[model samples]
Target: MKSNNTLTFSRRNFIRTSALASGGMLIGFNFFTACKDKVAPPVDISQLNFNNFNAFIKIADNGIVTIFSPNPEIGQGVKTSMPMIIAEELDVAWKDVHVAQGILDTKNYQRQVAGGSQSIRFGWDALRQTGATAKQMLVNAAAAKWGVDASSCSASEGVITNANGDKLGYGDVVKEAAAMEVPENVKLKDPKDYKIIGQDIRNVDIDKIITGKPLFGLDYTAEGMQYASVLRPPAFGQKLVDFDDTAAKAVTGVSEVVRFGDKIAVIASNTWAAMKGKKALKVNWQVDSKLENTADHDKILMDLLDGNSFDTRREDGNVKKAFAEADQVIERTYESPFLPHNCMEPMNFYADVTADKVHLVGPIQTPAGTARRVAEMLERNVDDIHLEMTRMGGGFGRRLYGDFVMEAAEVSNLIKKPVKVVFSREDDMAAGIYRPAIKYRIKASIKDGKVTGYHLKEAAINSNMYGLIPNFFPAGAIANYKVDTANYNSNITTGAWRAPYTNFLAFAEQSFFDELAEALEMDPVQLRLDLLQNVKGTTDERIQYSGERMENTIKLAAKKANWGKKQDGVYQGFSAYYSHNTHVAEVAEVVIKDGFPVVKKVVVAVDCGIVVNPLGAKNQIEGGVIDGIGHAMYSDFGFNEGAPEHTNFNSYQLIRMNQTPIVETYFVENELSPTGLGEPALPPAGGAVANAIKAATGQRLYKQPFIKYIGMEEQELIG
Candidate 1:
């Protein structure tokens, strides 16, 4: 799985061939090209149609190449970037390439999920081979026509040419190529020769998106389809006791009221009517578990951190001995509350279930997994379920759950009709799969002006950070490093939100570094550089971050922001982090305005390998930084007896446009395969802003939603 050959089309057995009735060439290949356990389907050259193509590539007679992007696109630009990888190797003109979103085809695709920002990274080699293999077949066909050696014939911009200057369009010889044997090995383009990649390609759906066309799940409609609005328990620990739907049935356009498990669904001809009818229904609920509150969670997390019973994630040396011998031990505890994803389009899914087949179409991050779940719930064959993906307004890890998809499928199965389930803003917020509330206590022992010991303890709700995270950054630098984690199982649901644990962890650790620098009487940027230098040549596999890349990123951000040189009224703070296979550094500029800190600008430096599309990459970076800053400064969510305090935007405070600072981005140039860009840039922004606020107001923020401690004294806020 690491090499290009293993990803796709290294041997003839991995290729699938078919003929086009229009005399064009079609190439299909499995993503798991080197998997020995699975067998590829036999080639069928007699199938004379384009519909039989396995959602990979379709070459038309007009020399236009259609590449299917086989990954869910949640506004991360994979729908455009994934196909760009194929077209780059296909040697087709960017103008002649038509990008399309592929359906969930587990037969030919792998890792179709959209979370983790890994679509481009994982699909890079496979997609390149897919296009290269087809190009080789075309070249072979063209060489046969001229009776010349196939090696002398090369393809570029959808044309095949020989050494004698004989030119033929790919379409002109596609018919002959359809009959040719699949090529076992094909030459890929060198990164220096790339024509379509590393270019600013606009989003493929930009036109439709700007014109407000039907490109999102909410815009989907079907014949005789009913819209549904569901009502679940208002509180996390509540369960359904009884319900009365008479008022709902009397509402206009109300068709049916069906109760399933602990929820009730109101079906109607339109979304508004369904929502209105659902509001009219009366239901009773009983507490099924302890109604935990924010105060209770805070106490529990503190107790867990103070207790000795914990899982040791990573321990490098004797932390206890290092701490005992230290001259100074600086300790700080950071806390963050649960947060909602609050996707722009809310949650909605369309499902049409029948005895014969089940049709589903919606914006889902995990379409293949959702389909299997639906199939299991309906007790139908997985092959009988057909699901389609639409462009999502925004996911940020919310759509990965697919709970709304299950609701739609279940409702359709019960009503025996096509149904689309939609969640109100309140429902989306109150009944969300939230980011787990977490607290981290980081202690650094400084001896002889050098860090000798580091210990981090994490207490979380529901789940802890992934095991691999404990190995990232400073884990190899500190000689006596130790990481411990413990979790409290809560009835309230929690799951991945954007960058997950790193979103808040970065702020905690990076802020601690700034404090450590202050205690050592050293510059913060120089302190990070020195730490990275400690692990520069180490060969320890446990360390996940690249010290060289992280050091370069930190230098770039510091140089751009003029790290130590200060302006009269401006204060700056620096933070650097590595996450999701990307290295990022940020510097936040803050100024005091009427006794309040105002963020004026942020300068970001990233090393995510090669840039696929600069425009799209910049968008991701800027969006992440703004989102991180917004949440860290303004957004706050708390639970009162298992009920969310803020259920809508009115109560939930988000950073306003006027408050958003200007962001400048710079990327390191390299030939390495592209890594994720969507979430890596976010984790460092919070840390940068927190450190900046400290410089501006002499206040150290240990809790999220920095606004809570805005006017309070440092001692009062810390206490």
Candidate 2:
């Protein structure tokens, strides 16, 4: 089930070029026709002897092609896949093409932030056009040399061949092409003709990564840069009052201690010295707000759900009337606790601030925004700031916030020197932005054994679900539907963690759908298929998910997992969800061991459009499923008196190697532009696992960290 459609380029407005100083060709084009501004050349164009070239592609006289990947690499594999799209259209050999991480250049790139898993979807057209236009220019140049029409020449594997079979390498004609006019409406390759895109291209940085190269932010360093370790309030809602740096300054290798807005920064020659100095400092703090606890959060969230004040997200077909007239009603509430991202490499950033200019470098998800914020904080012009992106060990949405980046810049500005701020694992977990605790209450009204009404209420900490989420799956499927949301603001910082609201919301909704199927005495797969039929051919603009795509995904997953087939000791569960413009379905197979449900395998099917790289796409799906299962079954983070209860792995539980299940991935291949693969696969995993546990043990788990509901101690689960 793969797409064989050919992509056609219609509008080609922004096509420009400049001759490379090395007698090569530089092609620059804008994929977004709406942006009328002329493409600007790179700031270091002359220094690098490479012109704008769309700031994406560069060709050398040695036949080597370099493509620049503009987005942040958060292990989602965009760095590899993005260039593959360009090389596919550019018609170049991947082995001869080198991929480089582009610096922050807002003038040449848009939507460079990497949080939404949209790097490819947004950059697809632009990247392809860039490569295709370059290839066209090369062909035109070769045609001119042969005194033949461009149509008589065809390019493949970086070589242009004429109808007579005579050929010239791209580099041989690059100099002539550099002086030629930029072509408009260059033809893009058909999907069926793709060679580099769908092939198994290893991550470009794989060699460097395995060889211990300095590609991550934690490995970034600057000449004469000092290391910094900061100490803030021990708990949320607490503020710094006063701090004594006498003992801290006495520590070996301790250089100086600086205070900035409720936090103390200990500067030293090395990270170990800085952390030691920070530990020796004496600080006093006062509670500035309510010291909230997990219990308090639970009570407050539940109360918000019960209260009348709520923001109505969506409503249709008189839910009250449908519920009142229904023959039966089923309701369930699901609860989840806060969770930390726990990225492998702790939060770290490098900054050098001076009166005239600012240099900031690190693994930041939002590089442009962070640089702008730094400029505003220092009262400097944005142009004076030069920011570089380093590969991130992991983001999971934590790196989206620039607080750590700001810390490095602020400290460097205060000291008037270069500094690298490093956060210990404890600091990362204790003070990091967390996935907010959330509770969902779903109710369904059944009339004549068919779902007739649906109502959903969400209560969260700090924020509610995004407005468009209410219009996702199950919205158009059910006739009478309503959604309400309320939130309780807490001083404890909370924000997007991976899939954001859908990560947990899918578990709640999908689990409820399974229960509803039981009440109706209908197979879960059949129930979903029936609901999807209601939304088929739907013209509702508010419905974000395509019924056709969801159905295909669910069917593929079920078929692959042998859904509804009874096995001697195996129990199976199915869950499907749509998020980030992608439809994904998963089937979990469970087996009991020592009175505990163990997930043995998970079959995942995704409709993220044509996967750019099957290997990378499969890696994303596997990682997401494992993450979802780990968090749902073992990981738990709670706040006690405004302080995180678990600060590191020793206390915070994660699914270990032996507990991981086998993941089988399948993609519904289509010519539709790829949506998001990073987070969509995760949202359905929790629900699939939860439903499978229910089937295995006949116990309905209403809360996350299912280990808590089972009669197993934390140690036993860990073992």
Candidate 3:
């Protein structure tokens, strides 16, 4: 079922022997491992096969370059930002470059999964190192032709320049360069000398996206491709029992309806037909009444938190003893709910399988991981499984799972034809792996208007956050005495979503500090400054934040937001947290509208190393902030009979344009390596907004989905 129109880049195989490949569907140029030696070949645009292109790029006989990315692009602007890393150091003009998704090759591209705000951070070294090698090899080849010293020729702006000012384009010398060996030690550009990095660049895919060029998985169609709609388990752990496919086959355009194990699939000629078929198909839903998670799930979580499964994330002094001696001890418990990714485009993928090969494509974030799973499922060599990633609608860590990929590949294998699996908004909501619900019990001791001890005892699944680090952000400088965790197992499985544990930890920690600030009659900003001023510069690997960056972001956000300046009728609250290798500080200002507090404005300060694309970077931060607000104030994860409570936008809530407040962002000046932006901003938004709610209503919220527990939701189902 491979698209006949796909281009064959056999020339690429002719050159680099060290290329590791991953699944990619369409778009981009190929990036080979270039060391101090030559790479496989330069990209030649004229040779491009636009219609039926293999995922990884191939260039020959010219200086054209190709790039195939394996992750889905769900409105994080990854289609442009991720490729910029390769184009930057490759010394290629933006006009001369083309990008594509890889044709599911895993040997060269490992960790093709995209989450944890890790794309740039991970590509920081590998892609640059490869690009430098390619540039060096090009220079070396030109030097050989001119019969001059290698040092006498330098590569710049896609051309090799000799000391005498003679120039040869990268394309001109690519053939000879391809024949050269990869260099052992290629010099990386110093930040000061960077030509493309650390500079403001517009998102490259902006034009394509605006023009509506079938860029996502839903847009993918093979000549004989069919549509599929999966009827999943009604509830977690429930298996399929029996179904009648007669009605489904009678649906217009429906070709086949099959049941495999516990799931059923409806295959049809079009999306409309497949959906209609699913609605018409009737089945005995062996609704298991035993171990009903929707009813008992949240209660189980509450019990776990109430019990002694506590792990210490941070502790200073002896909280219990300090509380006994304290003139005032403020203790509060905070709870957060499970929420769906609810990305606008929903989850989708297309796959074609045969005994010889399997081709998978869609809006997937973890293509390499998908390839591995597909290879395992089909008993095929990992190298033989190909994957293509699509630009996503909105990925708040939803696409991070390779489950969708596996489902597509499995279905394709059963049908032995190309099929695209589409998840409806309902399917995506019900099928999604949700953000874990968590509880925080914060304890603090204050005496004589001075802080002495702070302890945060948090309980969660603990397995969600880790491994997005290029290197750890040093936070040891902060006066934190201890951090630990306790775990619990549940029937519903969970994984990473944005910043993982940091999201819960920051909301609880920062908000608790605000409470202490009010108790001591001190400014929240001043208290944080007092605590943070003692530390500067990056902490070692032992800690997770740059104490200096923390202080800087706090100061900048405070100064810009006017923390102490009183507004006649408005209330303000502040919060700051460091995660994703990015330190973010935010302030939320709001006022009561009718009965509920509505945010009026937000000010943020960020330090994500260097801002590669200011517009793009700022956009990510803004979106993160809004996402955080929705989760804290309204995004509730409830269960009814062991199933997720909300199934669509109607029951669930999302902050929209009218709800978005004016956002102001500032970046740090120093050139540090890039960190993550997608999730760090999210954690603090909830805290900032929660703090504002306290200011506006004189009531502190100790629970997530703030509206639900803030005397908002009806009590009928809350119990």
Candidate 4:
């Protein structure tokens, strides 16, 4: 099942101690405690296998170092950055290190997911320890060879040196190092000694990417792989009744037509043929009357807004008392529509299923999850399923779900042939696990000039909007605070998209806070700072993020943006939020031109602790900001009669080159452990732009895709 010409790295080449005895070092570092199944037999760890280690670092006798980048790369630059941490600690040059994408081996690389912006957050300490352990082993080996004390020998730049000026390369003593036992506790390098981490290292695959090399999911192929296109139900709640393949089978290059319950697949020799065959498929679907359209779903959400069924996620002092005693109470409702991921590369997976084994290769955010799903679907053992990950063009939390991976596996399992199921832009758009639309109602109590109370009630489809993060910004800062959530069951499928709840919640909360500040005639930036300052010294158990870190990012952002400064034809808006253990604050500068909001510039300040790669970090911030702006200003997934109305870019509008704005990014100087870099910066961008639009025109957009609310003639704002 292996492709010789492919860039896929397999775990089959894992070096054992016997292989290492031939003058090479193979170090296995166990970072995670593996979950054991009671039904499965015990496994001996005496043998050096990839499954026994969380990650494997190999140094050949020729002095080539290879460190496995365990997680899938979805253009977050993890492949370049994660290995950089290891290379820094290994005392090797970055150029000497070969960063290989690790295969799915949960016994070793457990919890290998690319979402939540958590790769660096969780891998920071464990990966460093891995490298440090290897370095200590090498240092010990070099000392034993030189007949010197290990403490007297120091390692640098892949070489060991003693006080007598005797030197030996790491490769010379690697065989000896491989024979030594792994160190239990090895001291990691200080931040001051980080030569590779803070430096601006280009992405590892930059050259291949720029030169049009094949590395993405769409580029993956195996021997005799046939392209496939599936024809799913036309609507969310519909099911396929029957399919006529008479016309589809007649198409050129068409091979076979397969049906599996509600889905029908058209297999062909090539992608175009498969697409043509799919279009020719006459499939009849039975539609469900319930959950027919977006409007109907909106009504359901609105009804649940006041429904009696509610869960009190977080509550403090009496909210009723604060509101009753307040001089005035301000209430507002915000609405956000469902959104499609629209990754640069559409969904696709290649599966070659035989009686004994199921082999899959594609772009997936969670390979381990996909493997488990395939194993369950095939009723096979988990060890028999081999899943390989390719470089994804974009993830944005869309790949977190393994439905597409399962589809390919099931199709291959049934057909008994190698199949590559490719999703057209329309198919990817229509058949979606979209970001759930939400309705949020916020009420604030104002007594004199200080805010006394804050309450938020969110109504979403299938699940609550604020599940894990009930205590958001101003949660601990407000005396009387409460959060209520309700869900409206529907047929629409929903999954995590980027920052998940915070993607849209940050917009609702931060924009409402702006209105609260305006009502009190207080500066928005100053108001957030004041609120954060209140919780800075408190020992409140409700605070999830460090109050000092949050406050620092806010102050630093304002200082960088020149908060009080004014420019001609430009209005500024401020927003701050914390998510994925990262705090971000942003200020947007916009100008109204021809009745539309034109973003001129954006200033972003993040406190994600120590940034691993400055260049990649800035790129992530800029990309996330632009993406947030695009979604806030343009993106919306619409449905009519239970069918997705916008299926392609012709109907769906995305951010264009001309629409991109200048984004200035700054990272607060800190020595704390690094947080995520991909998603935190995105949430605030939406609110910042919305607030900017409000400042430009005396209009508050309560609904998302803000273009729907603005009018040219009268500027009538609508919710």
On lDDT, the leading prediction is 1
The alpha-carbon lDDT assigned to residue 184 of candidate 1 equals 67
TM values, all candidates: 0.95, 0.96, 0.85, 0.94
Per-residue lDDT, model 2, residue 205, is 92
Badly placed stretches (over 4 Å) of model 3 are 1-64, 67-74, 147-155, 162-165, 179-195, 287-298, 311-317, 461-488, 534-541, 709-719
Instruction: List model 1 lDDT by residue over 159-208, tens digit each.
Output: 99999999999888888887888876677887778898889999999999
In candidate 2, list every pair of residues with a backbone clash: none
Of the two candidates 1 and 4, the one with more favorable TM-score, higher being better, is 1
lDDT head-to-head 1 vs 4, winner: 1
lDDT of each: 0.86, 0.85, 0.69, 0.83
Displacement of residue 639 (Cα, Å) in model 1 is 1.0
Off by over 4 Å in 2: 1-13, 31-44, 47-54, 106-110, 464-468, 711-719
Predicted structure 2: lDDT:
0.85
**Better-scoring candidate (TM-score), 1 or 3:** 1
For model 4, how does the per-residue alpha-carbon lDDT over 1-719 read when each residue is reduced to its tens digit? 11111111122222123125445776655433332222111122234434445566778887789877777899999999888988988889887898787777432344778888888887776667667767888899889988889899888879889989899888888888877755555677778878998999999999999998999989987889999999898888788788789999999999999998799989998999999999998878886556367898788888877677788989999999999999889988888888889999999999999977888999999888778878988898888887778999898988998888989998998888999999999999999888887888899999989999998988987774324368678888998999998887767788888888799889989999999999999999889888887787778776887788898999999999998788788999999999988999999999988877889899999999898999999999999999999899888876887788899999899989999999999999978878898999899998999899889987788887877666533233323
lDDT for each residue of candidate 2 in 1-719, tens digit (9 for 90 to 100): 54323344532344566567666655555533323233344333562332223454778877798776767899999889988988999899998898888777443445578887777778777777778888889999999999999998999999999999999999898888877877656787888899988888899899999999899998988899999999978899999999889999999988999999988999999999999999999888999999999999988988887789888999999999999999999877788899999999899999999877788889989987888888888888877888889999999999989999899999999998899999999999988899999888889999999999999998888874332278998999999999998888888888889998798999999999999999999999999999999999998999989999999999999999999887999999899999888999999999999878999999999999888999999999999999999999998999989999999999889999999999999998788888888898899998999899889987777788888876544344321
After superposition, the stretches of candidate 4 with alpha carbons farther than 4 Å from their true spots are 1-22, 34-51, 106-109, 289-291, 464-468, 712-719
